[model samples]
Target: MRNSRIPFVKYLIELLIVAFGVFLGIMISTYQNNNRTEKNIKKSIGFIHRELKSNSQKLDKAIAYHYKLKSSFDSIKKELPSDLAMENYYTQQAFRHNKVPHWTGLGMASMDNIAFESAKISGIFQEMDIEEVQAISRAYSYFDSYTKFSENLMEKLLAIDSNSKVADIIVIFEVLGSDIIITEQRVKEEIDKINSQLENINK
Candidate 1:
């Protein structure tokens, strides 16, 4: 009876050792995986930050261009006569002498979204804090809205007739210029928000 008990005890000890080894292996693998994920998240955030910075610079230039264009359009409108025939004659002279701004002169923002889109596609947002994700999403939505607005404005400008009276063209330009000004203000606000958020994350 004593010999049989000793063999059964040895078998139980071996089984316990095998279980311990398996648990240790699993713990090591989990640690390595978590470390890798953390590094990836940081790298992706860096890319996104750079992309945003580039976009902010682009917006700054666009804002300046739009302001100048608005001023020029306003001044030209004041110089033109209200009568359609006189306005058309002055418009022709202005075009011939390079006094008029072309419809294609307006600056387009063309904001960058590749980094943000890539991160979204790769599921990196899933790992981010919910608030961080929401803030970034909001910023990109502003970018989309601005792009669409600029495109539509350009389309309207392009559709104008070359023979249109100076008064009529100036009216359209003034209206569109006001919209551009409003959009620029909103974009500036978003840029400020983005800069603040970036500062917080960097800290």
Candidate 2:
């Protein structure tokens, strides 16, 4: 008896063709999406790099300003012992360059984490290695801590009264003087580390 059915080989070939077409479509789609992601990563990195660089510059200025304040306070401390006779003069000098405003601005200033944050929000950070995410988080954590310090310093500054004792003012200055030096050193180190990581990512 003659078979009416199509050969099994013919069906196999047809099914393979369909499978290949589907696989090819998927490959093309994946390639395009990967390319898009790469572009986005590069663009975001560029923006982050620029913002970080700017922040570094601002920090440098802030460090200098704080250092100057430290020097001023040192001078004031020297004269404090005998300055009772020179009360008005020393008091005026002590209050001369109130660092509160600048420090407040520095504390309140925003760091550019837009790229990092957006990446997290969009789940791109999940694609990053755990170490990379950790490094970024650690860097930002330092900044957050610094912000809190600034807030505390601002409160201290606000609490200063014209009638406040010179000894009290001196104490605040000494604390700030030491704190800022430590902060400046740490900031420089962190910036260098973060910039190195960013450059690696850019490459």
Candidate 3:
């Protein structure tokens, strides 16, 4: 009876040892996976940070260029002649170097979104905090809106005839320039918000 009890006790001890080993293995694997995920998150955030910075710089340049262009248009409008024929002639002189000058050489806010798109494709957003994801998404939506707006404006500019009257062309430029400025300002606001959020995240 004593010998039989010893064998049973040995079997029980072996089973307990196996269970402990399995638990330890699971713990180690979980730790490694978590570490890897943290690293990936940091990498993604870094890429996004750089991309946003680049876009902000580009926007600044675009804003400056558009401001100058608007000023030029305003100046031309102020000095335009009252007579239709004279006004057309003056407009022609104003744009003598380039008809459709504003559209032909417009300052475009060609912002990039490759980093953001890549993050989405990689499913990184799933790991990000909901609010953070939302902030980034909101910023990108503004970028997209601005892009579409520019495209439509370009189409309108291209549709204008080369012989269109100066008054007509000036009106188009004034309106479109005003819209572009407003849109750029809104985009700038979103960029500021996203930058603020990024600062908090880094902290």
Query: For candidate 1, which ten residues in a row score worst on lDDT?
Result: 89-98
Q: lDDT score, residue 110, model 2?
A: 41
lDDT of 3 at 127: 89
Weakest ten-residue segment in model 2 by summed lDDT: 100-109
State which candidate, 1 or 3, has the greater lDDT: 3
Ranking by TM-score: 3, 1, 2
TM-score of each: 0.82, 0.77, 0.85
Root-mean-square deviation of every model: 3.2, 4.3, 3.2
lDDT of 2 at 52: 64
Model 3 misplaced regions, further than 4 Å: 83-104, 162-168
Q: How well does candidate 1 match the true structure in TM-score terms?
A: 0.82
How do the residues 114-169 of candidate 1 rate in per-residue lDDT, one tens digit apiece? 98999899898998889888878888888889889888766766666666555555
Global local distance difference test of model 1: 0.73
Best candidate, TM-score: 3
Superposed by TM-score, candidate 3 places the C-alpha of residue 141 at a distance from the truth, in angstroms, of: 0.6
